[model samples]
Target: MDIKKGYIFPKPFWSSLIDVNIRGLQEECYEIRNNVPSKYKSNLGQNSYHSPNLLNLQNPPEILKLMKQITNCIQTIHQQSRRENVRLVDFWININGKGGSNVPHTHPGAKYSGVFYIKVPKEMKRGNLFFLRDYNETYLTSQENMGFFKQGYNLLPYDLPKIPVKPLEKLLIVFPSWSPHSVELNDTDEERISLSFNYILFR
Candidate 1:
């Protein structure tokens, strides 16, 4: 049996855990939680500190340096010829505790969005990120027509309706702004801290 795989409109993204000062980033999160005045409560998460604009804010030198590196990494992943033109537009910090989770949402105006995981509980239940696949393909390949293909390994791997992504400390995940994604409930008592950011190209 010979089978050829071809991608029609495959969604592509990038993720990695780079070497950084995890402990220092964790400390910075705590400081933001304690000192930041703005608290974003619209979402279902436990608590979120929304910065006005990370690029405009007078953040610590260390934090700004890391953001620059993240932008470079994302540019490399996308294979853009003008690497210096890519920039991170904004970013915010999120702290999800027990029973907290984010609803499905997409970035509004940015070309790309990403999250950097600083702190994750040792025992995480449902706090992982899950990307929702486009419904057109799944709806067309319903049980009525694709029932027989589900028997064994007959169906291709790209037919799934959702994709779950695990989180790790020092990890960075970058994807298109239009991708719909949500977080599961934080079952563990400890807090899940992450820095979410958006990026755009100037040239």
Candidate 2:
């Protein structure tokens, strides 16, 4: 008998190395955090500063340019018809200090969501981002507990409960808005700064 592999339903996440001024972006973000009053937050945790919707405020030039780059890339990737278009509906800043962590959550109402790492400390732990699988899917086929844990067996994504992602400067990650994700506590002394946004498809 012969057996092969078939990739069933796959959830994809796109990441790109964005070209922007990280230092300048950091200064701008800090200034905004100092002066601007936060109206909303991204992650619910302590020792973190979350900004409100930047779409409603005077965003820095670097942020605006970065947004243009992101939207342009999305347009190219999605390749929607002339009748359809995509727009950034909301955006914010996240600066996670030591001991900062967020509860698991998902973006609702919008279509796509993403985050850009502006700053990340060296030799960090508990600062990683984790994309998790749905809880209801924890049936008998659950990857968390499989008796077949033997030698010579390759571990695929289907056999993992969560995927870990290390944050790097200038890295941008885009994914479906409904994907549930969370951040671990920032155990390092340095801070972790990132910009998050959501996009919606419109006609």
Candidate 3:
């Protein structure tokens, strides 16, 4: 007898390290964090600073370069024509210090979201990013665990509950805006600095 299986319902994210000045980006974030008031909070918790929208930057050349790369990525992900541009609706900085973490949340109103890491703690798992499976009774009654075949360590995306994306300097990641996700605590002494933005296809 012969047997076969089918795959379905896969969630996806795109990530890469673009050719940009990492040091310059880091300095830019620090400058914003120093001058901007982040007294109000959103998803960020303890020792974290969330900057106001960065679209207002007068002439941040490095940041503009990064934005160009991000737009290119969005277009690539969607297989869109390079000439067709998407609007960068919002842009901001995130600085997470020791004990900083983000609550589980999803971006609304935007079609896609992304992040760019500038400064990350040398210690792995410090402020780790995680992608969570949508809340549901998925595979509740399936006799076999989806994450692994009852034998070898081959992993499947469907069977897994969540995915942890470790932060690394110069790393950039993009995913559906509706994807639920969060961050782990930054136990290390250093701060983890990253930029985040939302985008939508041009109408």
Candidate 4:
């Protein structure tokens, strides 16, 4: 169990499981912006759909089945880390359409969190998930100085070293729960489907 700080678990493929879970989810819930007030209506407003927590779903059997598969995957990761005491919070599916995007945020009080991209539409121009660097807050402020400062004098955030999005099929991206991350807006006209979940590690 040698987990390094900021360690990323390699992407895992669970096509069959994903298919089953997504099928059930699609039938069960409609897409809504994550964390937005009920009165809000706009794709640009913190865009992302969150399914009800799996445990609270009206159809518990289907939700339970999906939970089992998700937990099994988490168990496998824990086994590899030789860490057995991992407890998963319920999972949520995120459905995004053209112009939809998620704001930067972290999962509070969880050890690790991850997303599984089930369906990535071909039309998407910039729908990749992005992880924020430790300096993002300062970097964003620096962007304002670009107009007044000469080239190279103004620090552009992207010019600084950045971790690139690692591509994979049916990608499962795992990171510390508190890591800031976001999904770039889907500029193209198509839907993006994904699921995110959290887990706590106990000794």
Candidate 5:
């Protein structure tokens, strides 16, 4: 007799490429950060410098290309047809200085959201992206098997909860807007620059 036990859920997926023009992107990011008015600056969290309008920057072809690739990957995974329309509603850059970190939160009114790591220090001391699993059967099941089984992609450990994302250069991660995520404290002296955006689906 044969039987199968399974698991299913929408988890954040990411892709990376080492060839993207990082220096160019960084230059543009710096310019935007410097030129934007103080009214547009946000210090609500630990962000040292947040660009007012990332996608609105003039002649921002690199960012646009990255956004297109991200959306294409998202649509492809869901098997959405080429004709289905999806558009990015907003995007911004976050420059996290030392001691900067974000509290756990979810995007309230968007179908999909994501982040792209533009610049990360060579030797990162603390800054990292951590994702939390929402309370569900998986959480309960993982708890039950805490000490017995090891956590692998195939066999998950029940006790293991938050997953940390490696913020490598030119890495992009996409996920459902409702997923809860947070940033670890940036203990390093260098700044951590990244772009965050939200998307919506249209008929």
Candidate 6:
């Protein structure tokens, strides 16, 4: 199957298992947040540095099990692609509260990146996942060659497309790593819990 650019893959086959473990981890992380003292919490902007205050799971036995399931899903896609191999470099969770958001940025040095939404409240007004349009080369070419009769060139200011927050229970979104993306701030009082991860494909 030829996956189109910016195509959001259907929910992976093993997502049910992933959802179960993610729910368990989310509950545990929530409890930890409530008990632990956090000196600073995220505000509405790009993350400057990863917080030690937040739980960072790299190779926990439970998380590893979850990662394996995710890896299997990614591998299934990789096999269909021209490339036949892939690797999961790392995975981590982000706990965003009201007003916390990430600025537009692309994953550095990875082939594919994605996020699995765990919790989304009903009151959030503006929080959504956004993907930047791939336009850098096209922009430069258009600027150099002023074409009056270009076939498909519709010149306009570019804006990233936003994926609205549906009932984000078990939604897993994957996109190219070079695709710049961001998360909008949660305007309401509730928190948004999500897991962001990346993988490197060996061609």
Candidate 2: tens digits of C-alpha lDDT, residues 7-110: 87899788899999999999999999899776434465566898888898888899999999989877665664244578999989888888877777889998
lDDT of every model, 2 decimals: 0.76, 0.83, 0.80, 0.60, 0.73, 0.60
By TM-score, how accurate is candidate 1? 0.85
- Candidate 4 runs further than 4 Å off: 1-25, 28-48, 59-64, 136-161, 164-169
Candidate 3's C-alpha runs over 4 A off are: 39-41, 80-84, 137-155
Q: How many backbone clashes does candidate 4 have?
A: 0
lDDT of 5 by residue, 42-141 (tens): 3334447766655665647777777777777667644553455567878888888887777778888987787889999887967788787666744665
Against the true structure, whose TM-score is highest? 2
lDDT tens digits by residue: candidate 6, 1-203? 98775634322222232455656756755654555443333335332222342224333444455567667777876676456688877665666766678777888898777777767777776778765444563454453554454578664433212334343756777767777677877676676777667789776
Q: Comparing candidate 2 with candidate 4, which one achieves the higher lDDT?
A: 2
Q: Stretches of candidate 2 above 4 Å error?
A: 39-44, 80-83, 138-140, 143-148
Compared with the true structure, what per-residue lDDT tens digits does model 1 show for residues 1-203?
A: 89996778878778887788888878877776677665563347545444444567667655766787798788886566444456787888778777777777888888789888888999996788888765675566666656745356654547666688898998899989989888888888898887888888776
Residue 23, candidate 5: alpha-carbon lDDT = 87
Where does the lowest 10-residue lDDT sum fall in candidate 6? 8-17
| Model 5's TM-score against the true structure | 0.77
Could you give candidate 3's per-residue lDDT for residues 1-203 as a string of tens digits? 79998877677899998888988888887877878887454555578898888786663778889898888788788765345557788888889888788887788998789888988888745577889876663355233543435677676665566788988888998989999888888888888888889988774
**Model 3 lDDT at residue 49:** 92
Off by over 4 Å in 5: 1-4, 8-12, 38-47, 57-59, 80-83, 135-158
Clashing pairs in 1: none
Better of 2 and 3 by lDDT: 2
- Ranked by TM-score, top first: 2, 3, 1, 5, 6, 4
